[model samples]
Target: MVMEDMELERLSAAMDGELDDEKLPRLLGGCRHDPALQESWYAFHVIGETLRDPQLPPVRLHSRIAQALKEEPTVLVPKSSVGSVPLDGATQRRWLAMAAAIAVVVLTTALLRPSLPANPVIAQNGQSTPASTENGVSDRDIQTFVALHRQGSPLSEFQTVDYTPQTIAQR
Candidate 1:
């Protein structure tokens, strides 16, 4: 009796260690009772071993494989075009509605955002003053504040120490 092509394919896959875990036990159980499947399994292993080392004895398999191929039916059906199928009108409308809702939310958020002050307050001599005021902190005061800030910064602890060859020798 001719064995099914699927069984033969599974046997081949089992030999190659590519068979799924769920189907492996079923394939092994089939091999236990089926002599043809057992022979096919042995043949596949011999073929693998021969390929790995040409020095090993080669077994005739071409004729058996050719006979099997001749027995298998040829299928010429076209591949399914499931991916190319167009979306339904309702789906398209739903996607458009979602996009419109997101746009509305973004526009509303932007419109309702708090506006920044035209003339911000400037800290001058520990007192807050309107930047537009004549008595507001000058550029010199800003420079002094920045210098003080840098001096008090935590990273200022890593300040570079001036050294010379003479200083090293003295130490």
Candidate 2:
């Protein structure tokens, strides 16, 4: 004769054991037949199992210092096993390479520290010629350039075209 709401109330109270003795089995039996509540129970149990698995990483540690206190101590190495550390050929080569690398870095920094002025120095294309030819361009070269510029100039009043030069001897 118990209603559905009373059954649910019994189930909620059963978790903390506040339910009547006779109602406990009925509340459990009601949940078993309820698909939604049964699914919720399965999900809760799955979460519990996932949390209990040791292979899974711990999500939260309360404090690093407190957690570190629980860890086992590692023993120090015995002196009998330790010997005089000497460099072999490979170790010597590695040390040499490291020294070379450091030297290269220091030299590079010293060489490329930009001691020059920051103003951009631009060189003109035709500004400077070597001392050997410093008296400027040659005369014949200038004459040849003038002749070519005159000969094929479309902008000139007398335009350049296929024209024949007449000789006095042939006339």
Please report, as a residue range, the 10-residue window in candidate 1 with the lowest summed lDDT. Answer: 131-140
Q: In model 1, how large is the Cα lDDT of residue 163?
A: 27
Query: For each candidate, what TM-score against the reference?
Result: 0.29, 0.22
Q: Model 2, which residues run further than 4 Å from truth? A: 1-4, 40-171
- Candidate 1 off by > 4 Å: 1-3, 53-171
What lDDT does model 2 reach? 0.38
User: Residue by residue across 1-171, what tens digits does model 1's lDDT show?
Assistant: 355789998877765557775676677668656756766666665455434332232222322232222233322233565546565896667557546644554444334432323456544444543321211112223433433444456766236332221222233
Best by lDDT: 1
Clashing pairs in 1: none
Task: Tell how far residue 138 is off in model 2, in angstroms.
Answer: 99
**TM-score, predicted candidate 2 vs. hidden true structure:** 0.22
Q: Report each candidate's C-alpha RMSD, comma-separated, in the order given.
A: 33.8, 42.2
